[model samples]
Target: MKKVALIASVAMVFSLSLNAWTLGKLGDFKFEKVNDNVYVMHGPVMMPNKENGGFMNNPALIESKNGLIVIDPGGNYNVGKNVLAEVEKVSKKPVIAIFNTHKHGDHWFANKNFQEKYPNVKIYALAYMIEQAKDNAAETWYGILGSLTGNLEGTKPFAFPNSSVDHKETVVVDGQTFIMRHPAAGHTDTDILIEHVNSKTLFLGDNLMKNRFGAFDESSSIFGNIQILENVIAKKDGYKDYKLYVPGHGPSGKLHETLDPFLNYMKIIIAGAQKAYKNGMESYEIKEEVYNNLKDYHKWDDIEGQMGKHLMKAYSEVEMRDF
Candidate 1:
């Protein structure tokens, strides 16, 4: 992706001041600068709900020559609006694009809100995510989260990402090269990875968490997820000297150090679940067994809700030989 000289003109016109940033809070989270032009709003480990103000997933903002490019805006209107509020403080330029890493609500439904704010902006996603967003896959989440969030009135239904790209597709937006990758079937069947070539940053949408593993639905695969993480860790030669490894949740950090915890957590979870199955224990019983064995890791982040569900899923993932 060759950079256009005009893009530099566009960047120069906007005198964006980083010194006067909104350092207080965007709802309950803060917009943190992880790299030279990349800003990330790191959300809490808790699930998406009214209590957390719908700030459950990390939304990253990339400043480019043309305009801002938002990654995984969020699950609802409020979170997206909050992200936009922060964007307004940082850059006066309009948003040129929005990329959703997957079909998960906490990852992408905010497309609608972003559209209303920046009507001409393009929303990009994997073809699978676009298909899921149009069909019952997204509809089911509308119902699930509606109830989970106690029918949050302003939260809208899924707005499908219009521009769909295939695997290994390279997109040049605002003078930045974004290389997208699909790592088997992990996180979800439609998990899409975005590699910002300029920053050497990888925005892993739920494929790998930083300090803690979070709860997931039936579409997730522990085995496939392990493969994704292993590939990322091994490919440091390609993704050399990582400035930031952004996960869907948790604080961003160096790729290897950030990914090590999730890898170790999965190893212990899968092994303990397999042991529980051998002991003739049910999923519910296995949860207690696995939790007892891996109790130390429960302190990672939001384990009160994520640990039990992860153990159950790990047991099923192993039982079905889907690893």
Candidate 2:
């Protein structure tokens, strides 16, 4: 009787612990219902660090009739555990599926926990994303996220996507319809923008951000991002006019407030790069000019840090087109 009582006591403690969980100084995070059955936990906008524990991107959820569908779980194992704990608060149903946005660890590394807990959960991502995850990207991001988060506990990459999704692919899970939209190369070559068709919500992934400036690495194309954003705003390519836009990082909002600002920022960067290219100036030479044009985004997170690289990338793309 004592042994059985002790087990019950331990279970009670574990449940209470999860309920009272706090992530660093960020406090308790719960999934805020954005639309009908759709919830989003907007994580910290700052760079990964010990304080933030590498939790930076927006992890979202869609509650269908029988189970839940998660988008971009989070950074690492423990973060994934915490995410699921928060998930339990919203719905007791099992997470039947997950969709990774791109190849970024911060967005998908948490697959470890989900795969561990729910062995049969079908994790989905772009084919390129799955390839990168199996290749060196997983280990590479492990080191990066570990160092950034000060090697926070259980920050390993044990699991990656098990299923591959493609552009315009319709995935119906538990009565919810998810439409995958692919760009040639936006935030990254592996980027996948998910459209939850029923609620009219489009998950822009890192292809769009609210008020934050993200890095455009070698695999990313400024021109590609601009074209995709233009098409989305114009509702081309059989895309629906979405009622809600959820960025990979930052808050979710309507078109003008969420996506337009970043689209305009991209335009300004490319235009500045164009002016520099026409004048026989280098990418670095146009930094100040582009920065000046981005006055509205000056206060955005990581602008000062990412502006130079963004200008360089935009200039390189412009030069390639001219030649």
Candidate 3:
């Protein structure tokens, strides 16, 4: 009886351990090999009701001949650690580079973790993002959320990138050419797009979300975001053969299917906001009117609250004279 009990206990412990390492959910991080050398590891999406639903989505991992390049390491250390472990499972080489598509915590908060693990790894980000991370107020606010969400590990004010690229730059990694382009400022001061030349894969961070939740609060200009979407639509026409397109918030896409709906929504909101601004409507009034108009637009129920919050921010920024 003692032997049976001991074996049973050991089995139970082993099972628990295995379950912990398994992927969490659809929004949780998962790994996929989109091409021969490129791999994408998507993080989980925390919803509003969930404790940390707004924390981190999935990150994308790209393997090149040079080494490994990870984009937006998620919001916490554990997410970064899990993604690193997944990469190691596939390749024995160290992660050579890390990229931040923007300055948002969910996208770039895990930089310190990756840097600590891979000391020689090169960190790449836009110049504006490096500056934005220095905002004490923003850092403190996000720090509180990170702590609440249990994502505060390695969450200190991060060091800026040793290498910065703006506008358009190209680097050859593992024989594959990656073109990093800052088409225009939309989601934030800087929104970057990474394109793998050979494979025709594009990694669009928060600038493009698969879900309609459409968080534009962090954006400096909602009109600028609309222009960015137009640019992407124009680019999509040229890359009809593109295989994979990864977003910051949801699953990947093949064509620019996700871009159209988002652009249309932005146009509608901007038109309404323009009328309100012309009519000398206060910021709050404009926000309310726009929210009511878009309240029932498509599947608004899924992300109305989050979208409303962003719309208010955008209305204030876009309509405010100083902004």
Per-residue accuracy of model 2 over 65-180 as CA lDDT, tens digit each: 99999999999877888888889888799999999999988898888888888999999999988998789778877888888787446755367899999888999999999999
Of the two candidates 1 and 2, the one with more favorable TM-score, higher being better, is 2
Which tens-of-lDDT digit does each residue in 1-323 have in candidate 3?
Answer: 99999999999767645644344353334467876567776544434223543344657777766577787776655556666666776677778888888776767667777788877778888877667666542485466555556556556656345567776788765676777778556777777788778778777777676554545644557777777667666764233345777777766766567566566677767766666667877545666667666644546434655655655565565566545
Model number with the top lDDT: 2
What is the TM-score of each predicted model, taking all chains together? 0.85, 0.92, 0.79
Between which residue pairs do clashes occur in model 1? none
Off by over 4 Å in 1: 1-28, 211-213, 236-241
Q: Measured by TM-score, how close is model 3 to the native structure?
A: 0.79
What overall lDDT goes with each candidate model?
A: 0.77, 0.87, 0.66
Model 3, residue 283: displacement in angstroms? Answer: 5.5
Model 2 pairs in collision = none
Candidate 2 residue 42 C-alpha distance from true site, Å: 0.3
- Per-residue alpha-carbon lDDT of model 1 for 1-323, expressed as tens digits? 24777777567545343333232353345567889899998876666666765567888999998799999987776666667776777788888999999887777767777788777888999988888777766777777676766634566655678898878899999799998888668888888888999988999889877655666677778888888888888774244445779988887888667888888788878887888888888767767766777766767766766777877888888788844
TM-score: the better of candidates 2 and 3: 2
